[model samples]
Target: MTGYDDKPWLAAYPPGRPPHLRRAFSTALDMFDAAVRSAPDAAAIHYFDRSLRWAEVDRAAEAVASLLIARGFAPGDRLALCLQNNPAFVVGLVAAWKAGGTAVSLSPMSTEADLARSFAAFTPSALLVLDDLYVDRIRPILDTGDTGVAVVVTTSGLDGQTEDDPRIFADVDRRRPADTVDLAALVDAHLPGPGVLAALAQRRVGPSDVAVLAATSGTTGPAKGAQLTHANLAFSAQVYLDWSGLAPGEPVLGLAPVFHVTGLVGGVCLAMIAASPLVLTHRFEPAVIAAAAARRRPVFCAAVITAYIALADSPDVDAADLASLRLRYSGGAPIDPDVADRLEERLGGYIHNIYGQTETTSPSHAVPPGTRAPIDPDSGVLSVGVPVFDTVVRVIDDDGADLPVGEIGELVTTGPQVIPGYWHDPVATADAFIGGALRTGDVGFMDADGWFYVVDRKKDQINAAGYKVWPSEVERLLAGHPDVEEAAVIGIPDEYRGETVKAFVVPRPGSTLDVDAVIAYCRANLTAYKYPREVEMVAALPRTATGKVLRRALR
Candidate 1:
């Protein structure tokens, strides 16, 4: 059983998923075969100005492989993909794999400094950049910094396109002196038929090799690449697919960025998990999403809380009758109780809570498929659900001892789904893992029923006037009130107390909410020190892409 204690209601882990296929994928290259096998023309991927079937996508990837071979790119060499959410992103990634190199995904929105920092950390030999993003911003940083990349390739104008000017996509291969090779021509030459044997021979790549280079701020501090084997990614994809229980060929929406784990796994890996067709709203535009929903009606979507909030408030949002939707899930941050309730009220059963971090690849927790919890009980619902398909959970103390039922402690996880360590940082990895379990750096406790509750980030705890207060607790209490629409609690600096609790609230529509009443309500639910000493009413609370309340931003 995933998290089942001796509880009466929630039972053991689902039976379909056994404790098999752990640390499974040695590489991610298998998804391409799976995609091609499942549906050659299943509307495999839809993105900017183009839609590709499985067969077409594979051909393009093979072309990318040939181009790398022509430049003498090696097997273990790294390739940085510094592009926004576009079809080229997938082509570059898959192509890098076909060519036997690792693709390092870079956030398109990252500043030049961050981009340079990332590039230097991995020392990718080449980069595939999008024309839309400010690629020039990172160029100066690369020239002045360490780890100078050898090759620069433009992905623009690759969709069967070529102009007389030919200025677009003039590949800058240092190995090939004179002019860069045309990528489109390379791909056209490799069209998957009798002529394909020649192209495949040139690239000479296959499975059992690393496909993606995953980098994150490792536990110790500096950025390090995880070296995700193709098997690891394939295993993660399989685990996520089972977690959702969606049909194999269902249409899923990709409305998030491709840079982060959320987008890569949810938007890319998960779509290929079961070879599902994907509908992409690349840049996450609210109007475009509404338009897509009105027209295409994708069956499933993996999104964050910010998108939910925006859509909920949009003039076009008609929760009563959403089109082409099987499930709507939000993660990346805690979902406010009030927001959750309103979404349920509007969209019927549109909102579900997913919980995970970059470490888990993507989501390791989600509401049960048929959960009947109400939105009014949001925090009660956000409690991380049962362990994922092949994951394990444990709550422990500083001495590395496991705590009993209902005891609060640092959440530690151990399972095939959890990465044992970060890239190139043994010290950080040692500090993070205890007895083979990764310490999540989150404060939480599991009830006897096996439901896990996230208390807060251990670092975010506040000491107000010598009393310990958790913002999640206070905010949860505030959100439960009928008049409160939304609430965010943070620590405000105090001369005498060191740090005082401050509550920023948004009142519900058609309610005259006052501070005295709110403070009085908190006083009834929380201890004296836990009550907000200062309350400020605002139009809205600041949030991240996934709807996580940006408590650090509140002044």
Candidate 2:
């Protein structure tokens, strides 16, 4: 932020400004430092009805960073952040960077076994956790392990102390005064000693050093941490900031956690770089988030499609304030057009489908309004946008052959935005990177205009009577039905057709749902081979941590 603020990467972004390529000070520490300078007293985070201003967050992060340095913890020490969305999470993130260490994200709700696996793979020097369920689960997991994890801190209950050792510090109220050892004071107290702050000012971390280790959010597999360098996070944050037309100091509604790339980069890190204010929610609640969205009058709100749908249906929805919102972004799962149409009508905002995964650091492509992909309602929903700036997207066959435009194939992506590889998972890493491109298991295609459309997965595609059908196409079609609350599609074996298209529909609380009626609706919208041959109603769809629906769980 100091030496290369004028670089190309930091150039005028948003509304399609060029990328910022800072040779110096691309580290997350400098980004947070700049935020502290730009909006020192503005609210940086608001969660659980508690707020922390930029100045406060900056000092807090600094204090935490200095604490690590004073303890002789040098740069590159991995710190596992296993807490939920809170001011402490941000404090820990910046603190790690300020101390020249990388913050590795751990899912808020990892099982004991999952935590153990992560600890062994990354071998982080410390683990920061919440006390109640999170820390409790992790403590037991470590008790069973032989690895020497040096630091363990709990933010869940920051009481002076009960009985924990090797803690960085206990929690203290940012407004309270006491010898109370909390993270804020920890960083501030350590900032001036041992030339740490001066070294921080110089900014040693950049494109080469790993900035974050984010876990994969794919369903049906063990999560793998993605080693993202400083350049990866910086480039991703810069691209999203530019393409979305978001302005500096814009108000961003934060729901995603630091554990996910989208949540961390777009939700937190982007806000830091732009000095944008944030309205926080510990966990997503449809009505709660909608009420806050209305009151906050945020510039941009990004989350999954379900959250958008819930906001539109919320009784407390203030369509007017939401109307002031510049853009609404959705990721995690493909957007149901019905949801998009409803949001446009209620909030007067474009329904943008941001295509991304944890591996890419967030999103690159977004389908803005006025660009509608062809509505097959049978084949699949077309992704109505081109690749993000400087990013390349391709469709390829199994053998890595380039498929002609408009033909279905595996979606492969390559760019500065793409992740290098999965951390410690050599086999998965090798299989994931095909021909220098990250092989997104997603099955999609590119149109003549170079727009990408996600159909289904190679694993999810259904073949019935030798005809290929995509589940997303049928699910989107049923989403338009009034009685259908939610839908998922899968395939079942059929004696006559070899395979038959099957649909799982979650209906309105009291609405009567019949497979015949739903199939009749798809019949009106889809081709003969694409229509669902069987339909079953369900209560809810299984979802992953990032809120992506798990279609594989279909009955």
lDDT over C-alpha atoms for residue 375 of model 1: 34
Residue 303 lDDT in candidate 2:
78
Please, what are the lDDT tens digits per residue for candidate 2 over residues 101-200?
A: 8888988777787878888888887666665544357667766766556666556433322232222223422232221234433543553555756866
Q: All candidates' TM-scores?
A: 0.82, 0.85
- RMSD, every candidate, angstroms: 5.8, 6.9
346: Cα error in model 1, Å: 1.8
Error of 1 at 194 (Å): 9.3
For candidate 2, the TM-score is 0.85
Point out the worst 10-residue segment of candidate 2 by lDDT. Answer: 1-10
| Local accuracy of candidate 1 as per-residue lDDT tens digits, 1-555 | 323333322353455545445443345666766778768887677653356788887878777766666677787777788865666677788878777788898866666777777876777877777543424565566557477576666654344222212222345221321223334555667645555446555543444455566665332244566555565567677766666677788777776666666777777877776677677654665656666566555677777777777777777667533566767777776666667778777665657676666666666666666563223233353565656655667777778677886677887776554554665668777877666666877777776556666778776789887887888888878878898888988888999889988899999998999988888899887878888889999989875433456676785
Q: Score each candidate by Cα lDDT.
A: 0.67, 0.70
